[model samples]
Target: MSKISTDPTRRALNGPTMGTRWTALFHVDPAIDTDPVRAALQAAVDEVDAQMSTWKPDSDLMRLNAAPVGVWQTVPMPLLEVLVLGRDIGLASGGAFDMELGDAVAAWGFGSDTADPVQIRAAMGRHRNTAALEIDVAGARVRKTADVALDLNGIAKGYGVDRLADTLVALDLPAGLVGIDGEMRAMGLRPDAAPWSVAVEAPDPARRSPHSVLALHNAAVATSGDYRHWIDVQGCRLSHTMDPARRAPLVAPPASVTVIARTCAEADAWATALMVLGAEAGATLARQIGLDALFLLRDPTMGFRSKAVGRLFCDQCPEAAAQHAQ
Candidate 1:
């Protein structure tokens, strides 16, 4: 009988750049070289940062913002796709997730600069431009009747995670988990034949404990919250998530919203939309749209509380089902 060759599997790779860390893990032959895979994954991440980063004035997003209205300015394909998706989601969620909030985000100090009172007022008074904008993806262009600035901060990271995972798979490593910041995508099962486990961080600024853990087989997870990026003005805390209608921070803070979906982009947008909608309406809408989501709210007296929506959490949380029954 011929002896069989058995090879150990390589599982994890990590690199730091783009203001955050990029992590990749796969169950692949350990004997197979992984340096090329690492390099390709990092390159894909760099491409995403270059195209969508608001911190970079020369980024494609900024170029699109500065471009003249009603003109078909050619832009990189990735940016064009993200913008197109933003438009679709904005309309789908009734403008809850607006990409035309660049001015608002920057004015609120969510961008690369400090908060400016003048910009904040202007951003608040500015009319929403997303409702009037149109995108032509096939033509690789966009047009706006009114002055509108685009920001992909909400969806870009998740999209980047998806891009990274796709890059790994294209390089013949189909079983891997790719993550940037907190947004992540799991391509296949781990080497132990178990689903990839990810922790959903608690929204408590004072606590680093994870509130919930998810077992992802082949899916993407994205979380949006008010805890990380915020401003304090006269003892009032303000989050980066702007209400498009008011063009300011959300009046009521939602501790956090975590979404698990088929694609990172969808999960990202859904998380933002839920944040904007607040807990009650957001939960209702999420169920109506059949989204898998977890909404965490901060209590004035109690530290934190949570609610789960959709089928994904049905098996995980019996309380969610019990609450639904009542």
Candidate 2:
């Protein structure tokens, strides 16, 4: 006679979306079939990509972009929700995280086409007037009061991650961790009753490695950094994140900024906002808003130095400070 183990089987699944991959991790009974769950996950992300992708000319976002200013455009509820949230974050971040930078993004080669000097000059010369977006929630429509090219690249993936988590819950599968690219959301604890462990990637383009780790349960985390995507111009390496005021890439920004929030969408947008604000101003805003954020700065001598705000990160600053100092 032999004793049998009663532990649930761990499962990991991933699929392509947004030129990257979306992933789900969980534990369930070994006998349970996962095909339905997998399909649901894929469908959830597909819906997001269809509605929000700037690369797709037929996407709802592009349709709105093409629409003449001041004319209302009908949008799906999901897209509407994202648009509303993007506007809110833009206001909250004091225009640091702008959605109306699509022109600048496309001109810089971060969008559908390669960089164009002619378009870049035009983008840079434009005055900074944040768009006035109007949302009719009941009608599920949105309109812009001015000429603005909207982009949701900063927040869409986070919302996609949220959808994955929601999909898992709808399927009656709790206890899971879901992510699109590096933006992640954690549901209930693992089968063994532990929070999901997520790594904060180091801002090193040469290699992939962890700078720190977070234990998340019912929370989400996201990071914005300079290393992952960039372009070279006149011997200068510029990050993909644009400065809304200048309508150009940030000249000086943190190596990376990581944010933890109740929703992945909030986390993702704030990370980008903080990157624009830099460590000093960002730390102030994070503290004022009760946000948990970690700023990694490039230090010539120490390699990387960190500045943390909010209780979650400050509580662990001693360790992070020591590690980053070296």
Candidate 3:
């Protein structure tokens, strides 16, 4: 085991938003300069951006999407790992979480370009049910019976956060928190022997306050909400989290789902899955699978109301019971 040190002050790096503002922090030996660590952290972000970003046409994900069916296209190991994990989670969630929604996302104007009804409709028409995708893990190849474009926006950032954390740990500095946008992962504890703290954003766009704060150690947290990304068409508001079955933006009112798990990837996917499940069904499913989750619903008179499911740690304490009426 590497010697855990407490002599150095923590170092942090911040940069212009790639899509959004991303921040990384690590506690390293005091004698080490910060520039090299900053460079390494930025390199990790660049790798994720090049391989997983949907905004980039030349990204590895796009290559896989453009490949001919039945032909195995070699892909970067990082992307391959993400796809494999994503497919498994999609199956486990009963299609609630899917990567084959590239068309839906692009049509909704959440992708690189503005929304095009024609492209949206075309993408919808080409939507190949995720169930039809055949992935050979041992072979490191994937085959789709029909044309289904892939998107990793839902879980990629969380995976990136995990990757950043892993990179920090590999450098022998395993104690710190890494967050991209709002998704985050914390390892070990702060120098004070307490867990790192994270604030859960309020679901309401009108409200800028944080509703709650969680203390986490060696775990990850991810939140999915429609407040940040949505489109208003005529009199209706359509969110980016589309219903894969309907091939359209989620018709239901917006809600924020937050998930906590052993890894950021699982938490991210599960958060999206719970959003698709909506308040009632999502809470139930979260309980069934023993997930730490919080669902906030838009109440007509109450503004935003919330519920907690499974095990959750807030203020460094665990809340028992799968569901809590808040």
Write down the TM-score of every candidate.
Answer: 0.92, 0.96, 0.90
RMSD of 3: 4.3
Cα lDDT tens digits, model 2, 1-326, are 22243557899999999999999999887778999999999999999999999999999999999999889899999999998888899999999999999999999999989999999999999887765678999999999888888899999999999999999999999889999989999998887777888888889999999998888889999999999999999899999999999999998799999999999999999999999999999999999999989998899999998888877788457234211100
Model 3 segments beyond 4 Å from truth? 1-6, 16-18, 124-128, 313-326
Q: What is the full ranking by lDDT, best candidate first?
A: 2, 1, 3
- Residue-by-residue lDDT tens digits, candidate 3, 222-304: 99998878888998877889888877788774478889988898899999998998878887888788888888778889877
Cα distance off (Å), candidate 1, residue 309? 0.8
Clash pairs of candidate 3?
Answer: 310-322
Model 2 off-target regions past 4 Å? 1-6, 315-326
lDDT of 3: 0.79
Q: Please report, as a residue range, the 10-residue window in candidate 3 with the lowest summed lDDT.
A: 317-326
Judging by TM-score, tell me the better candidate of 1 and 2: 2
Best by lDDT: 2
Best-to-worst order by TM-score is 2, 1, 3
